[model samples]
Target chain A: MNLTLKVWRQKNSKSAGKLVDYQVSDISPDMSFLEMFDVLNEQLINKGEEPIVFDHDCREGICGMCSMFINGRPHGPKQGITTCQLHMRSFKDGDTIVVEPWRAAAFPVIKDLATDRSSFDRIIASGGFISVNTGNAQDANALPIPKRQADAAFEAAACIACGACVATCKNASAMLFVSAKISQLALLPQGQPERYRRVQSMVAQMDAEGFGNCTNTRACEAECPKGISLENIARMNRDYYAAKFASEEEV
Target chain B: MSSFGKAFSSSIGKKLVVGITGLFLILFLIVHCFINSLIFLNDGGETFNLGAEFMAGNWPIRAGEIVLFLGLIIHIVQTARLTYENRKARPVKYAAYNGSANSKWYSRSMGLLGTLLLIFLIVHLANFWVVSRFTGIPTHDVNNRENLFAVMVETFQNPWIVLLYVLSMVSLCYHLLHGFASAFQTMGWNHKKYAKLIISVGIWYSIIISVLFAAMPIAIYTGLIN
Candidate 1:
């Protein structure tokens, strides 16, 4: 399938960007979105033109490394799938596709469509973990976690840190991403020791990173490839409130 | 500021303030709607006048009015701050954003809707609140209470004011549609068992309350409630 692409291009982060149109012919319908980009890059190399730049790793969709706001969606017009998982067949022949990088103050553009997502790393470093000593592993049955709680935690853990929640949020809120990280540990026995501190610290870092607040629009949940629930956000809010108002620990 | 104050001043804390005040305003809407509906009794404003008198003269209700205004101020101020920061969060706008694909238009338009509602509130207060409290209503009912019912009838006579009321109620309807369920979520009150229930209740409540408020003016203008 042949298509017209209006992809945003920039020399570097300091420079301004604009949509540069490119025409690709003889594209296979079976090629993933990134694969189509590969074909385009091959053509650009043949012509000695600079190819478009984007982020992608683990093309299988789990890495959350692939970031593209294609045709107004985080993942190229599909639900619950990364851009790498999107196939060319989702579009018709001759369709004009618009590709742009994630827009958020916290996630600055590194180059063309690739962004610096290290802010997420900082938030995780702030908390987003269970403090376990480097020692012998305990018996699996030592901590009996309820199946329901385990399932919920697993669901929260499914977040890939793709930044789609922030990308798609009108407010550029990272609450969904932050909440998922908080909830993944908050629901488990191993996570209880630093549960309150984890939420407080992570949320503080999230705010310090200049991410916006959640307005309960639920766009994050809708655009999430992992289908992270807004319930995680509510859980985080509950934990944060408990930490501030109910926890015996002094600030 | 202390850590305690800082906590409440954070992003989530500011939202908590907005949500709490929004819920308080929602409660105020219920009380306001109920008292306004007394006009439907059509007993020549006797019952409505007494209700208005009680609302005006009662000590506790008078005190509650102060709290309500405080809630309103906090809600507006916090929302303004959130909106400003939210806008700044995305310094560059998307070249192609199909927001409707993932979220409701009204949900994304909360700032616009809230602004319209604020304008409506100012006009509404100028028409009724200021007259009733400070300037005083000129007419009186048989019970010697300020004839607020007569004031309502005269206010609705102006077609422009009626149109403004209807349009404002429309804004209020959309505002509450998102605000109601959003308040619950922000307060960490959402549960799977009741999440859907909360959304449905929000829809009905938004429609019912806005319709009731809007209908009062139309009813008065048409002489249905006189």
Candidate 2:
């Protein structure tokens, strides 16, 4: 299938960006979105032009490195799949796909469709962990976690830190991303020790990052490649609210 | 800014302010709708008149009115500021977009809906609240109540005023449709088990409250109710 692409191109963060249109033919329907992009880049390089740059580490979609808003969606038209996982079959011949970077205050453009999502790392650094020094490895069988809670925790843990939630949110909020991290640690026994501080610190850092607030529009959940539930956001709120109001002794 | 200031002054904090004030206004809507619905008794506005008198004269409600006013002021200010901030966050608008595909139109258009409500509130207060409170409404009975019921009967007689009131209720319907559940969601009251419940209940809550308030003017203007 042949397709036309209108992709955002920027020389650098300080440079102005604009949409540059190009065409590619003889594309296979089964080719992945990025692979098709590879074909396009091959064509661009053959013509002695700068190739489009985007982030993609694990082609399997688990690494969360792939971030592209294609045709007004986080990961193209397919649901529950990253850009690397989206196939060209989702489009038709002569289709024009518009590709752009995640538009958020916190996530700035590096060049082309790629953006710097290291702010997500900064939020996780703030306290998205259990700092309790378990002297030795504890037996997994020793701690009894409810099956339901474990499943939910695993679901929340599915978030790949892709920053799609931030990209799709009208306010550019990171509530879903922060909430997933908070819910992941807040749900387990090892995570229980520093649960209050985990929520307090993570939320504090999230605010410090200058990301917008969650308006509860659920676009993040809908566009999420992992299908992460909105429940995590609610859970984060519950934990943060409790942490904020808890007495010194209770905390 | 201090750490607390940073946290409280961020986008999240603004949303929390919107949620808290929004929930307070929702509560006020219920109370106001229920009391206003008393006119449906159709007993020449006796029940509605007495309810209005009590609300006007009672000290607790009189004091509560002050709190309600403050809540409205804060809610409007915070909502406006958040809209501006969120707009600033996305400096480059989407060249090709359909936000409604991802979320409801009402949910996305809260700023527009809220502005309409603000206009309606100004007109609404000018029509009744100012007369009842500051200028003193015309007397009706021997006991000399404010005759707010008579004021309503007189006001809805104007077709333009009734049309505006009806349009305002339409805006109110949408505002509540989004606001009621949004307030709780932002407050972190969402549960997997309860999230759907709150949203569905919010739909009905918005419909009932706005419809009840709307039926009053339509009923009065058409002489269906005195």
Candidate 3:
């Protein structure tokens, strides 16, 4: 299949960017979206032109390293999958695809389709961890956590930190990603010790990063490759407010 | 300011303020709609005048009016700030965005709906509220109550005014359609067992309240309630 690609190109975050169109022929349907880009980059090298730059590490979906807003979607038109998992078959033979970087002030465009997502790292560093020393994996029967609570925690933990939530949110809010991180710990027994402090600090970091607020549109959940729920946002709100009012600690 | 006061100024905290004030406005709509619906009694505006007079004269209701306006101001101010920051969050706009693919148009257009409602509210208050409270309506009911009902009848006589009310109510409906359950979600009151119920009730309430409010102007203009 042959396709037309309108890919964004920029020298760096400080420079202006524009869509530069390219044509590729003899593309296979089974080639992943990134693979198609690889083919395009190979062609650009043959012609001594700059190859299109984008982020991708694990060809598999779990790495959360691949970031592409393809055809007006975070990962692509398909739901619950990353760009690397998107195959060329999703489009028609002569389809024109628009590929852009994640558009958020917090995730500034680094080069081409790549962005600096270190803002997420700062939020995590603020307090998205369990400090307790569990010497070994507790015996399965020792902790006795309710099955329902454990399942909910697991669901919240599925967030890949791909910044799709921010990219899709009209406000560029990181609430879904932040709330998912908060909920993943807030629901578990091991996460209880610093639970209140965790929410307060992480939310502060999220706000400091210049991300916007959630308006409950649920666009994040809709475009999420991991199928993360918006319920985690509500849970985070609950805990954040509870910590503010109930805790006496300065944090 | 206390830490509590400081916390309330955060992004989530500001959203909490918007949600709480929005819910308060929702309650105000219920009261306003109910009193206006009394005009349907069609007793030469007697019952509607009495309800309007009670609302105007009762000290507690008068005091509540101040709180109502405070909620309105806070809601508007907080929303303005949020909208500004939200816009700034994406300094560079997307060349192509398919927002409809993920969220409802009304949900994304809350700011637009709200600005329309604010303009409508100012015009509406000028028509009835100012006339009743300060400017003084030309005629009173037989019981000598402030004749707000008469003002409503005179106001709706203009077809353009009627059209404006109808259009405003449509904006109100779309605003509440997103605001109702959205307020609950922002407050962290949403639950798996009741989230669906909240959304359903929100849809019905939005339709019913807006229809009732819109019906008044149309009913008066058509001589159905005069």
Q: Least lDDT summed over 10 consecutive residues: which range in candidate 2 chain A?
A: A242-251
Q: All models, DockQ values? A: 0.82, 0.55, 0.80
Q: What is the TM-score of chain A in candidate 1?
A: 0.98
- Number of the predicted model whose DockQ against the real structure is largest: 1
lDDT, residue A197, model 3: 90
Model 1 C-alpha lDDT per residue in residues A42-98, reported as the tens digit of each score: 999899998878899999989999999999989979999999999999999999999
TM-score of chain B of 3: 0.97
Q: Where does candidate 3 chain A have its weakest 10-residue lDDT segment?
A: A132-141
lDDT tens string, model 2, A41-156?
A: 99989999999999999899999999989998788888899999999999999999999999887888999888888889998988887776658887779999999989989999
My TM-score estimates for the predictions, one after another, are 0.98, 0.95, 0.98
Backbone clash total, candidate 2: 0
Whole-structure CA lDDT of model 3? 0.92
Over B1-226, each residue of candidate 1 has an lDDT whose tens digit, in order, gives 6667867988889999999999999999999999988998888789988989989989999999999999999999899999999999999999999899999999999999999999999999999999999998999988887899999999999999999999999999999999999999999988899999999999999999999999999988998888
TM-score of chain B of each: 0.97, 0.96, 0.97
> DockQ score of candidate 1?
0.82
Q: Which parts of model 1 have CA positions greater than 4 angstroms off? A: none
* Residue-wise C-alpha lDDT for candidate 2, range B112-208, written one tens digit per residue: 9999999999999999899998988876754565578888999999999999999999999999998899888888888877888998999999999
Question: iRMSD (Å) of candidate 1?
Answer: 0.9
Q: What is the C-alpha interface RMSD of model 3? A: 0.8
